[model samples]
Target: MSTFGEINEPSSRTAWEDWDDIFVTDDFLNLRLEKDVDIPKEIDTFIILEGRYLYDCVRAHHNLELVNSNAEVNLCLFKTKELNNYVCMIRDYNLILSSEIVELLKKYITISKDVIAIVTKPIVEYQVSELVSKDYVIRSISSSKQSTSNLDIHFPNLEQPNIISGVSAGVLCWREIIDKPAVAIICYMEHPEEQQIQELYELLERFKIIPDIAKFHRDNLFNSNLYI
Candidate 1:
């Protein structure tokens, strides 16, 4: 299994690369898991797991018992190195969690005493908007057509500042409302933090989901389809 690269179609390859960077980074781990636990499963999967990481692109291993694939959670974070009793972990760090993603995760994740989850996407995504929209991205090394086992997220060929202003565009836009503690998940899917953050703040201000992202990590952020 080959990791996404500068093949004939670099756009797609680049998109995955951006996702790869975000998915495997320490900061991303915090944003997705909303915890301080250092996910020690990967350190350059490209170098450590190599072939196995590439195989992950298929993303066919949907069963939590099979591998680290789950549908129910928005999967801002995960860890799966072992198999056949493989421990596929999930954490919903978004301000307002996604119901679909949660349902999907539950479908495949093999439950045991160790299985765990936390937070809500609807609550999280809605709260962390200091600007109109910020990109929320993810990618896998598997060859499977489906990125995740469910509507985890979609790869859009749109421009930057893409539009994280959808359903989770802050609590005001959300249909069903819940006032859970707003969780801020940092996304480096853009650039020029000051500028990007300004735009995002404006967007959220309108909706009143202005984020309190006083502190965050910024490294390996990417442009939109320009890289894709």
Candidate 2:
């Protein structure tokens, strides 16, 4: 059988470079299976996986549960290489932790009584500020999106005082809630420091959901879309 992309791609003569021909057809659904594992009762003890590698980790480990992502979310993150596997992998996990980062933030806001939200819309910004005014920090950044490679800044110490504000404003806002350096760093970049990444993987080792991320390098990383 042909891979999903091979079957779907139009012939070179007829296809335009700008054409967005992707679709999440019916084949990619209901992939999860029932299983049991000892999940940490304390919310902070469990790890959150995001981006392309999330599917790989989920497919490889029965113990790691699906949290936020679904067919729609997977569709947003999909690239041509992995094709339908990305869509179907969502069904393999037993839990839906939370869908969007903002939802996760709201939970933290309730527990920590501390909030920091990133807003692109002025009207939403005003509403969020008003609702959380007593105990939250609201910072502004431009709504414009830019290519990831355009960013070249780095931070050696995340806990330092008076750091470069608004550098990666979205990431800076998330840093307010995520305590782990690994989580904040991954949130900041598509590709992050190898050592720090290894640190994160090692952290996962404690939970026995270790992903084969150690073998990742520049060439294969792009091809596999593992980092992104």
Candidate 3:
């Protein structure tokens, strides 16, 4: 388990920053069985979904077709706000993750149907220990100190170590707009192959973990003004 840097102020920007395990099916078994083998050499690549992409995906969960005309008012109210605030508010409920995200969304579906209850992972350390038990590593590179005045993109050198059989989606959290982004935990698969890779991503998508992946990207870059 690894730590994402220090947490900051307790604002409405409550980060589900604890780095809980991004839910995966039990099919994502442990890595101890093949810990001794050499990792495979495939081109390491990643799929990038922008913030809007995930926002749209979550919004898609709000199905208006089946609801009766009376419930339409609640749906209308739910549609008026920005996705980020809505998501932040939804996070405050402290709902259980025992089911799939889609299923959870269905259960706790309405924003207010008037006022939605706003609410506000893993240890590769304390954050994710219960979620992930597999072994993995964090790969990073620190560059020369750059000007803090411009909050531009800071790309990673991407000189990552070999991809293993099991690797969970990158988890990202921000205590505030000003802090640096960090990895939550890393997991490995016992054997890496095209099918397994596809399956891993499919499971993540099915469980709706893609938003956390996008959050990692969103938190890592700064605006031209150095704002998060």
Candidate 4:
């Protein structure tokens, strides 16, 4: 039998507009996220969206530092903000390896404040564990550093880790702004990390950032990060 329809198959070209993987919306954001935060490399930008030129737009705003040139690939939200909401199961999960795309992002995306500074390799979990285990790292990095100033970071439309991390951060920030009256949580469809989000909020609250909503969603209906 033959059916006559456009057959809205997944676009082999791109997927940034994917509706299946819905996170938070701009209105939901309530924050003016109109500004497209950036990464340093086009490959890093499209590393999740599946749009090559998209991240080229990212590089124009910031630089995605290449931590290691040898690993498979990783996306690092170094000193940043935005739902950038990306997800990282391991260290070398999603990274930009396309040299051409890298060049384009370098050429187009540049921002006044570097938000999402990415890396080419996954974050070293062992290193992070060591930092967490270090008394100096935790004590010196404490928010009570009288000279420390607050920074409001912004993530792109992302909603997994990058965006989720920011949202959780914002809520905790709000807590201090309002004196710890609120906090939040974020989650993914396949994986909901409530305890993780709460713990994250708790940690940030110590820094005086009131917390709010702590849940997120992801459908992964896209074909690849290069197009979506």
Best by TM-score: 2
The lDDT of model 3 is 0.24
1 against 3, candidate with superior lDDT? 1
Query: Where in model 2 is the C-alpha error above 4 Å?
Result: 1-42, 54-58, 67-69, 75-100, 108-155, 158-183, 187-197, 211-228
Q: Across residues 114-179, which tens digit of lDDT does each residue of candidate 4 receive?
A: 112222111221133223332111100111112122333222232222332222233233333433
Cα lDDT tens digits for candidate 3, 1-228: 565796556667645655545666666321121113322232111111212222233334432112111121112112112121112111111123212222322212222111111000111222322353443222322223222333122332323343211111111211112232222112233322111223223323433333333332222123124654
> Distance (Å) between predicted and true CA of 159, model 1?
38
Model 2: per-residue Cα lDDT over 76-176, one tens digit each: 21111211111112222212332333332233222321112211112222332224332222222222222233222232332223232221233334444
Query: Ten-residue segment with the worst summed lDDT in candidate 1?
Result: 44-53
Cα TM-score of candidate 1: 0.18
TM-score, per-candidate, Cα-based: 0.18, 0.30, 0.16, 0.22
Off by over 4 Å in 3: 1-50, 62-157, 160-228
lDDT of each: 0.27, 0.31, 0.24, 0.26
Backbone clashes in model 2, listed as residue pairs: 31-91, 32-91, 32-92, 67-97
Model 2: ten consecutive residues of lowest lDDT: 77-86
Which stretches of candidate 4 lie above 4 Å from their native place? 1-98, 118-125, 128-150, 153-228
**Alpha-carbon error at 41 in model 2, in Å?**
8.5
Supply every candidate's count of residue pairs whose N, Cα or C atoms clash at under 3 angstroms. Answer: 36, 4, 22, 55
Quote model 2's TM-score.
0.30
